[model samples]
Target: MSALAEKADSPLKKKPPSWSDIWLKNTKPLKHVVFTMPLQSLSPKDPKSQTLIPTFANIDRTLLLSDELLLQILPKLPHLQRNPNSLVCKRWLNLQGRLIRSLKILDWDFLESGRLFTRFPNLTHVDLLNGCLLSPRDSGILLTHRLVSMQMGSGFCSNRKFLEEDLLPVEVVDKGLQALANGCPNLRRLVVINASELGLLTVAEECLTLQELELHKCNDNVLRGIAACENLQIVKLVANVDGLYSSSVTDIGLTILAQGCKRLVRLELSGCEGSFDGIKAIGQCCLMLEELTICDHKMDDGWLAGLSYCENLKTLKLLSCKRIDRSPGRDEYLGFCPALERLHLQKCQLRSKKSVRALFRVCEAVREIVIQDCWGLDNDMFRFASVCRRVKLLSLEGCSLLTTEGLEAVILSWQDLENLIVVSCKNINESGISPALATLFSILKELRWRPDVKSLLASSLVGTGMGKKGGRFFKRT
Candidate 1:
């Protein structure tokens, strides 16, 4: 029991029992536990806490979602599912209606019954062409004072008889228009067939935001109603399509339209007959007019001269026209459109050399010229386009009579030309290309030369290694 004996005994003494060992010795033994009652109940309730639990069948996830979250999700669904989604609930129906911006109404009652507004309050575009028809699905004869006497004995269908009673009363049509105008104050575009002036006047007065309007079977008087559309920029007036209907728009209607819609930017006249006076009014008054499309027109002999008055006109399209002008008058008197940039002619009959030359003279300042499917456009007729010295883009298609030499002569004169597209021209072939024309093609910024199917197939097979000789079927020439 000396000091050395005490030190040795201290080293032998064990350290205090560790905490983990002490806890394991003091903890209770583990036992398996099982739930006695069912995890779910049909009539689950906590009476003591005064709370009611919901069942899976009674719970609705969509109802729990906020309107803001639903709005974000509903639009991502495909359009085909919209109709079914709308039928899910009243809230969904209202939300789906808010997304519709355009409607083509075939039923007049849908617009007149004040339902369209309640259902879709944000509509911006509407088309009422079919609604106004007497028998939309059937062909009905128009009842008027002048009637064509058909031979009953001839080869006419006996069952196909159209009577005047099939047409709707004028008053009934006006009521629908009034309802539409009152309900859709934000309408921006409208299309109607055989609409009266009174009906259109109501629409123009209410829908001041209207920017585009199309009127089929339009007459001189209908334009009077259209004049009220102050914001109107684009208009397509179809007087007649074929011999089926006899409606006319003359100088008087043109003058009214021009004076009222001074902000007009684009105008299309289909089967309309006008003189110099009408064209002059439009060119002078509609200072903002940029595009003009004339289709199957019946203008006077010297109506071409009036285009010069359109100082801001940029694009001119001639479609399915029988002639440019019977007589465009002297070249000195026919001034050019100062700001004209593009001239497009499609499916036109340019048979007369005199009229074609006059048209080329007027559009001499054009930068782009596109001629497609034009008949009687030979080398002599195509030469007239050489006057467009500033042309930068030229697209010629379906010009059967235009030979490679004719195109070369015209394009060589265009020193500023950068883009050229020639397709479906039978007379233009790779064999006709000269050294000078080949050099021009090389210097061009972009060139698409597929005058026939053989060239197009060869070009497509060029890089794919589909053809012989290293897939270089189309030579440089």
Candidate 2:
């Protein structure tokens, strides 16, 4: 053997250090070494400058090889262009489709041509707001069953042909709506405003899976077609008819709808001239009704009293429905619905405080009460809040008669008030709200008021207005 080979094979006189001893000696420099290599490699490499290639070239290859890691890092990269991450690679283009579930086609020309749905096959929900759904030249695009919910404007399926003078041709409206209804088989919810007679008929016959339907400015034909939906749970109708014309909806249309929909839970009728007989029909027929909103010109105390028989009603909203001046008989009849939880009466001239008190006494489970623009609600009605302790939210906006004393009395009675809004109330000053604030300070989550610093000091009793230097208000930051 040569001299170098003999020296390498010879055993050491002193004991050599183990792996742990070597690791302990190199630990401090390892962080600096590991960090500097990446920094040096990240600098721009120039082949003409004779810069040597990194020994860790394989490490860079290993880090960039993972598709999952690339996907996770692409979103974090800063760019000056529009969605540069989307333009990164084909993998990102595939991910964009999975992120979108609902698509609303607003462009009239694009929707009328039916090219949008063809591109996005995964779309299950579609909204055609102020746009027409055009008929397909080929049957393949119309027969793709994907859409489940749709909302459109009125005249969506009318058959009238367009003339040269018309901007929006009649052919577009007829073909678009017909194609949409016939295409989307799984559709369950349909909302249409200003619907034509033919459009109403088409939706009722074609949309078998529809559960909720809303009709605005509709005629008797629409109401009759809505009655045909067996699975309908909610139906809202806003009638727009001339004063000279009227429909059978006051009695016959309502009767047919109530009998047809056994599962009906919510029904809203606004701007309709329905009589007391119509109200009576609803109470008797809609046994499963949970919510009812009625707004009309002639709704009086007698019409409201007729709703007492509706035992399952939990929510009722009556707008501009006044009580008759001499309808003393209907006062006692108001205390019928015991299961009601929410009641909203706006612009209603409630006759007396006794009538308001009678309502609370009957609906003992009421949690929310809103009375806006109401005349004749005196101090006596404010006292009723004390008796009904279950109220969680209360709003009295534009009730000009509600004084500070009246507000204090109501607040003193409430033990579990969470939200209280008193707007446009001129009489409810800081002094009137101080006591209620003290009682509800800990429990109250939201309180809205517009008061000056002097009023705040007066209400807080920090500046001798109420003869106290400091109180709970000082500690409530």
Candidate 3:
């Protein structure tokens, strides 16, 4: 053996550390720099010209990414976590506050103060749907300046607004309206549940751009307030109340609305005790009115006579109503209005055959007929469709009195009939499901029970004041 081989084989020989061992020890920077070779390759030669390595901060981060990038990200995070992210740094907090434009707090109880307005100064929309029934002190805290669309829902007791005020020491008053007027001048759309007439009137004065409004349990004074909104194109008045007799919006209120709201194109009255005179006045006064929906409202044919004068009228929807037109002589004047296009009857009762015939005769020009949950209508009433040949769509739901045989005979004859929807019609299912009816339903398009699809779609569009034409109606799933 050579002298070099004898030295390698010696037990006392000092061995050099492996590359992995030296690299793993972070503290041994000098050894790593010398051994890894690559670490020192890019090391600055001039100590004076050297720069520190990049980091989350201290580097030219503003050059690499702008504040605008951060502003876009912070607000997009979930609301619960947004606060945590903002707490990370002052820059993050500033971006979060500046970037938020709209806020929708489902719980009103959690909405503590005007701090929300300060936090998001540029907010255009605010929806406080729940917790409208807050105490007087808490209710007073709801003040916004920049809201364009607002929907505040609350519940109240008492049939009359005045009674409600008397029962509850605190009510939506001029004070609240003053806040909205002072802050939300750009307000265009509002849906407030259980607000007083005076408060609504105050809104009309402040929100000149107001185009659409929905008020639950409105009264004559409320209608007067609505009249003040000269730009109003759509209005829905709901008179139903929880544990209350009814809202005090009768023919008197309707008359007020008809006289003042000339720009109205669509109007809906629910649970209103309005008669023919009030509705007739609407047709006579509101020249721009197009669509009308009356739900659970008191009426007879007097309104039908008046509807003949609505030159631009297109659609009429009767829901959960009874005796839509009983004044036989006057409604005869409503025959064959070419512009009237669609008729929808839902959960209604046509007490007399004469009344049924009268209603259908006026809608002879209607292209679509939607019938649902209507009683006192028999196979004989289905024959009305024969005369109304223009009806391309016939939708029937829960019409227990209507038989399939009677419907098949009338609908099949109409060449323009494009669609027929039959759902939960008890009498129709008694006999074997007619092959002809089955084939008709199978071939026809768009058939189903639409519970709230129309309203939901409309809310997403009209409630937000986002679309001009608003939502198209669809069957509910």
Candidate 4:
């Protein structure tokens, strides 16, 4: 044993005390004394003691985050709720001003109060569907210099209480819209549905910066008001008035619009009740028209024949146009649309095979065709697809006379075809589908048909032989 160990253990010879004894002897004040007598080490046997130790007051306060950092961390937080920054702390309140540049509150009563709008001054685009009681003055207040686009719902004009009590007659609605237009000088697009004629005129006059205007369920006076927009590029007119009768936008109104909007490229006219004269006027005035859609109106082959004059026309959609009879001269009219790329004919009663052949012959550049619920289409029409070299997508749904043989002929001829949809055609079966599938399996991306479960499973498991992977084949239920 060393000298230190021997002194710690010795009981005589003035042995130096151990470290623990020295500490006790050196201490001056002692509150209590404890004796360490040998005993069994006892501890509780509870299972929780072996589990995780419980802790209190473990909150960490050193990580203080700033609002700017929080906003940078989460930019899409405002889209989750209406005025989300308002609910956050005052530090986040300023974020609402920066984020709410485009506000679209549709039919939510909570947003009806103008308080939300007043809170954010940077709003540039707003769409109010319903729930707000906006007076003419209130509407003007909402239109600021920053606002560039605004869409007010039909409810604004249709409210019974506003019409009877609050509204300032038709003249007042016009003045309000005009005021809004004048306020937002940068306004580019405006859509007001179910408003009065005077209100429409107010919009045309005040919103001079408008490039596109859509007015539905209006009157002839409103159509006349559209003449004020000299720079308008696109116009949509939907008339629905009771007891107020007017000529179906005769040449007089159309001539005025065409002459005014020289830069017009696209025009959509539905439920106009106009004759071929209006269409002729469009053809004569708007020679630069690229896309035109005329639905639920009366138009004969003469009107279509006039459309051939529109050299720039690329897309033409005629829905429920029953006046276009399938006559021998129909092909001559179809020859006019040379630049046509897409043609949509729905429930038009197109029966003649020559008409179909003429359509394909005239519109040689057609890449897509949709013929739904058209009557009198037979094998001859199906055979016409063989000549359509550019056809990529074809939809023939509800064409009862179309059979698998016709589809097979069309599919086999289409080398560049990508998509083919035949819905509710009872005559089409797997035999006709399989041949085309084998030929264009590589290029084909989508095939929709109603086939048996076994055939569908087999087609899915065993691909068609086109030197490429097979595409998806959906079985209609």
Candidate 5:
């Protein structure tokens, strides 16, 4: 064999390191450089001359990428980490501003000076609560503005006069509203406190696309401005939420809202006092209305009869209500809502057997029923629900007074039931599950059963301004 061939066959000889191995072992860090096109023209006459030199510029790598590319990359990072990138340069700051669609105003000056618009030009949703709820710097408290406000009012027990003192002056909020109107013409949603009629009018004129609005301290006079919003669809009127504000939005405001905003799809009345006439007007005027919510309502007796007017209402939610109706009148006169598909009762007082039965009668056609954390809902009281024959879904939570027999009896009457959820019912133990109920459960398409789940003790604290508000969770306008 040749000498080279003999050496190749030698097992004792050490092999040389591969190029990948050498590259992997190198610990020196790499420096990234962005190359740009030449800006200066070359000297043709002295092309080879040493006197004329070529210069390479060091530039920001981010500038080379288009705004479209940067936007795609920035969103992949968490918002907390992504914030630092905006401080890098003016380009990044502007790009980051474009990404923000919602903002909560704490400083009224921020909105009044036009800085809000210049900074967040694309904002579609804005909350002016913090601005209106601002407290004097001299107050000297460690708690946040909202927490301080809540404590001052003593939770939901605060009277109207106390809340009035906490709110900002009307004119100050009006200036900020005007600024918001001029800048955010595409604004779709807004949450504001104590805005005057003129301020709201300005917003209505400018923000023609406004759809959802949550108004605090709303009154009959202020609703006149809102009526001008032709595209307004969803509205939450807070006339006198216990610890929040004091002014009342009565039947007059409801009538004005119903007549002017005929395109409304969803409406919420909180701490409002209205009778049958106002509700009848709403049902007659807002033909597109599909959902209606009444929280801590102060409507007079016999108002429950007015629900029959809402022919298109598909969902009726009663939250933290003390009573359905003091006097719903004769069962024949208390007509039912024909299109209602879902009836939701949470943290409500369902003690009066007559009112409870009337409520069940009004929602007789409901396909789904949810009863959660309601007081005075015993087996006898729940028997009233048997009138709802079309119920296909039933969920019961935090109903400590409800026994297994009560639920089983009501569900057995609902032959069309497909889904059942029973959770956190202290009285509904495993031993209470009857043979018939087990058979019915086996046939259900979906069932979530946890009868031993300790009833939520805090459910009773709802509407007391103790827990997080639902509006903050919704990201979409």
Candidate 6:
């Protein structure tokens, strides 16, 4: 075939795809893709070929790093590391949330419901402020709180006080529980105030590892919910929601709790009444019960009989406990807790020698003693404290009946006393501060009776006001 004729007959070849087309297919924004030459070079007739197109000179530095690398680096960098593109990528933002092992979310308005677990995955402990948790494991967060109390009788009508404490910033409804159940799979410890039965049940069902729980004014449903927590070791039942009526927790709920939570080791009941049955149930079932703290409630003097059953009980703390039996020679009926080791009484009524002896009758293994605001207790009560050879630490605060001579008598007899704290003891005046007491103070590891100790002994008369203020520190070594 002739060359000219053959060329005319041949089909035209297709142009290979250009860099713009290839790069544009893979890149996020086509505007970011640039070429060395202007488009006019390909089409000679274009009028604007002489003009130059300026490209963006700088690229975002973060965009250069791979998503995996960014995830590892983001947590190490401070929160405000780079403000420009903090959460440019969707996946990276989600990953950043998982790095948070501990968090306190004061604002529910900001949190998206049902995403709590995805937001914080490694959190082992959670505290709800009218809030709830999603799943995280292995990592734990610590929360320290004061033993905030109200003046002894100030809260008798202190319904207003309860409003501030037990009420949630926002009520936890069904949707909230549904979100929590789906999200918090590894929750180990939780403290939620005023949570309803459904919410409580959902947590027990979903958070299988839950060991510690604190709730206000529990009922049957709440107990049913907690019954499901097979690993529960610590429980604090708050009964002082002044505005709210005491529920079935006092007796029925307590019985169920004792029957259900057999693994319990520490239990605290505040502002609770009608205690013998409940206390007996706990002692009978929770053999592992080690520490029991009861405050601002009446358990009848007979409640001590039930507590005698807790063979493994180690520590007993009674604050403002009522029903003192000053009847003489009832020491036999005073009850005995052989395993008892540490005793702490604050603002309790120890009006008679029998009352004081009855309370201490069970403190056989007593090593540490803290007596505060027990005005009725005089030199006679100190005699009971003197007998415990295992006693190492002693703290006396607001004991108006205690004089310098009584302290001397007791301190001299205590064979193993290591630390002593006397604050606000009215009767122990300047004349009472003998050279011997000063010499004794010098030998101890912790001696807290300062020279200016101005008799806080009247704290009870001034009233145990509500809130965290107006209390002396009791350091446990």
lDDT per residue as tens, model 1, 15-91: 77898887667664421112223434433476554334545556677999988788889989998998899998899
Question: Which residue pairs collide in model 6, if any?
Answer: 121-136, 135-183, 135-184, 151-464, 424-456
| Pairs that collide, model 5 | none
Give the clashing residue pairs of candidate 1, or none: none
Clashing pairs in 4: none
Candidate 6 residue-wise lDDT, 1-477, digit = tens = 598777776676446689978886877555443442455345447565443333234445666888688767877776675333336666666667666665555444334454567667666666554343221223243212243322222223533443344344334543454465567677777766556767777877888888998776566567777777788999988766444335445667778889989999999987765556778898999999999998766444556656678888999998776544334235565467778778998888776666566566667568899998875778877877766767888888888888877888878767677887777776875466555655555456665553235543223222222122245422233
Q: Any idea what lDDT model 5 has?
A: 0.81
Candidate 2 clashes: the total is: 2
Q: What are the Cα lDDT values of the candidates?
A: 0.81, 0.59, 0.65, 0.58, 0.81, 0.66
**Candidate 2 per-residue C-alpha lDDT over 1-477 given as tens digits, one digit per residue, 9 for 90 to 100:** 698787777786447889989988898798799999998987657654433455554344634556566545554556443255556456555444333345665555664576654444444455553343333333332222111122322343344321111223434544555655665544566554444556655755776777777655455555666767788888876663233123334555566677777678898876655555666677787788899887653343445466676788999887665552224244455655767789787887766665566655555567888888887766766676566678887888877766877777777677777777666666666665564455464356655543222444354433322232322122211
Q: Write the per-residue lDDT of candidate 3 for residues 1-477, one digit (tens) a residue.
A: 699998988887968789877767765787666778975776779866545653344654544667878766666778799868777667667667766655554444233444555565554444433334333443433423111122222554344332233222225334444555556677666665556667777878877888878766567876777888888998888776434325678788888888888899999887777665886788889988889888877654455655666777899899877676666554446555568889999878877766677778777788999887788778887776677888788888777777667877887777777766666665654243455544444444444422222232232222222222222222222
The true-structure Cα RMSD of candidate 4 reads 12.3
TM-score of 3: 0.66
Model 4, range 1-477, lDDT digits (tens) per residue?
A: 698889876787576669989777756543232222222223335645532333223432322666566556556654666365566555556665655555554332333334444455444444432222234432433312111222223444332333123222454445445554544455566655445656656666766677777655445555667777777787776542222212254445566677667677888776555544666667777777888877665334444455666677888877665544344255545555667788787877666665566556655677888888877666776687677788888888787777777777776777677777776666665545564455454456765544322343244325543221233354211
What shift in Å separates residue 335 of candidate 5 from its native position after superposition? 1.5
- Cα displacement (angstroms), candidate 3, residue 304, comes to 2.1
Rate residue 280 of model 2 by lDDT.
69
Model with the higher TM-score, candidate 1 or 2: 1
Weakest lDDT window of 10 consecutive positions for candidate 1: 145-154
Least accurate stretch of 10 residues (summed lDDT) in model 4? 143-152
Q: TM-score of every model?
A: 0.79, 0.58, 0.66, 0.61, 0.79, 0.67
